[model samples]
Target: MSGAETEPGVLVLAATPIGRVADAPPRLAEELADADVVAAEDTRRLKRLTGELGVEVTGRVVSYFEGNEQRRTPALLGSLLAGERVLLVTDAGMPSVSDPGYRLVAAAVEAGVPVTAVPGPSAVLTALAVSGLPVDRFCFEGFLPRKAGERARRLAELASERRTMVFFEAPHRTEAALEAMAQAWGGERPAAVCRELTKTHEEVRRGPLAELVAWAADGVRGEVTLVVQGADDVPAVSTDDSSLRAAVAEREDRGMTRKEAIAEVAVLAGVPKREVYDLVHKSGPGEATP
Candidate 1:
């Protein structure tokens, strides 16, 4: 009885539904009702969830989102130390997966507060489940960098990633992201775009990168998750400048014009125009222009 009287030092990081309220884990309602304090990414969303669960949040409620996590974590930690069972939840999915709650979790660990999760629906896994890709090994690359240059550099680095890659992007940026991926990962790479998983308008568009880019150009709305095929150990195509130029020069020898040859070789070798040109130029004056 004395042990039972002792305050709970556990920090609960609960997973919320990504969509469809009915999909929420059953344990969530009981946890919310039993917690001494609840830290939510959005209090209004929490309220809505509680309403749906028909569970009253007798605990004190506070906001703990990206904007206030740093400031809020310490306060929540203080509550835990005081023997309060402080629960952290995001608007959807697991907190800290491209969402808030990372700071609070770190703070709790430092403060020696025990932390556990009430695992629930996840957009990443949901998308991957329907992706039909090689998920035996996979990596989640949460939301790509927003800037075009940084995003391209990131994608270029991931070009050789051997595991399936999952990413989340806003509806508006879906097309641009797909296009950039096509440029970096080859247009033929297989991918899937999952939107509004488990919701009424749930959609999964699976195809080559080039086709996905074209599909996205028509505009996609709602939460978006992308699963891209990883680099297979297939032998690299000969796209070195000289190699491409040789192929292009061969095309030229066959009556194809310089512009036509460059474009054709660039497509065949799966490389950029500038890359093919450099190959041709480095071949030296006389050696170039077959």
Candidate 2:
């Protein structure tokens, strides 16, 4: 008996090169030639890719994109169950990464099928690596809401996010998105706009949010990945007698009662409420009262 006939079927998730055909890994070609079924986000693109790499897929090729992923998952799962090697490749990058393939992976996992990957190029990491921003701790925000109000609200929520943030934006909406980001994250926040990464005409623009907004005003082109620096760490406030009293007074003026003001001030200044209360009391009635 052959190993392919005896071993359990496997689901292989392959990552296609985002750009630059030479980036395709060897394992990708090997699996393409050996798999029983090849599911691609775009079969036409897959054909071109195979031609460019001088590799031929012996497996049956089928479309597995956003529109038909759910409908096609069952059949693909059946292939895996029948001891057939099924390979899943997206148009670019890894499957289920702000792209199709999540549903199929989840289904495969639930069915006890062996799922593995052929790791390759990614636009997210590629942009971050060359973004000239902090990469140690970062978050991928995928794509923001397309509507103006929803997008604004979303940006507002991330205004204070401390980890460097990465986002994907359409070329046409790049200017509008940057303007909104500038409004929510402050004009001076540092960021990098990477366009057409890993391809000819690739451009990376790094500057304050406002500057990028201005640069994109006239127009911009190509696939865009925005990497924005996180919010600056808030400086610790001195908990001296005067500073504490001033903090409490400031909150009190903003409509907080003396007791409420002291507690809030203590939290902000990283001191005890009792300490803030004592400072407020020591300032005398004139300065303590809002």
Question: Can you give the lDDT of residue 257 in candidate 2?
Answer: 59
Error of 1 at 200 (Å): 0.4
Model 2 alpha-carbon miss at residue 170, Å: 0.7
lDDT of 1 by residue, 231-273 (tens): 8863444865556667767655544456666666676578887
* TM-scores for every predicted model: 0.79, 0.79
Task: Put down candidate 2 lDDT per residue, 1-290, tens digits, no spaces.
Answer: 64544455899999999879999998888988898999999999999998988888998999999999899999888888788999999888898999888888898899888999999999999999999899999999999999987787677556547899999999999999999988777799999999988899989999999999999988999989999999887445577878777766654544345776676567768888787777767677567543
Range of the 10 consecutive residues with the lowest summed lDDT in candidate 2: 248-257
Q: Give me the runs in candidate 2 sitting further than 4 Å from their true place.
A: 1-7, 234-290
Kindly report which residue pairs in candidate 1 clash with one another. 241-279
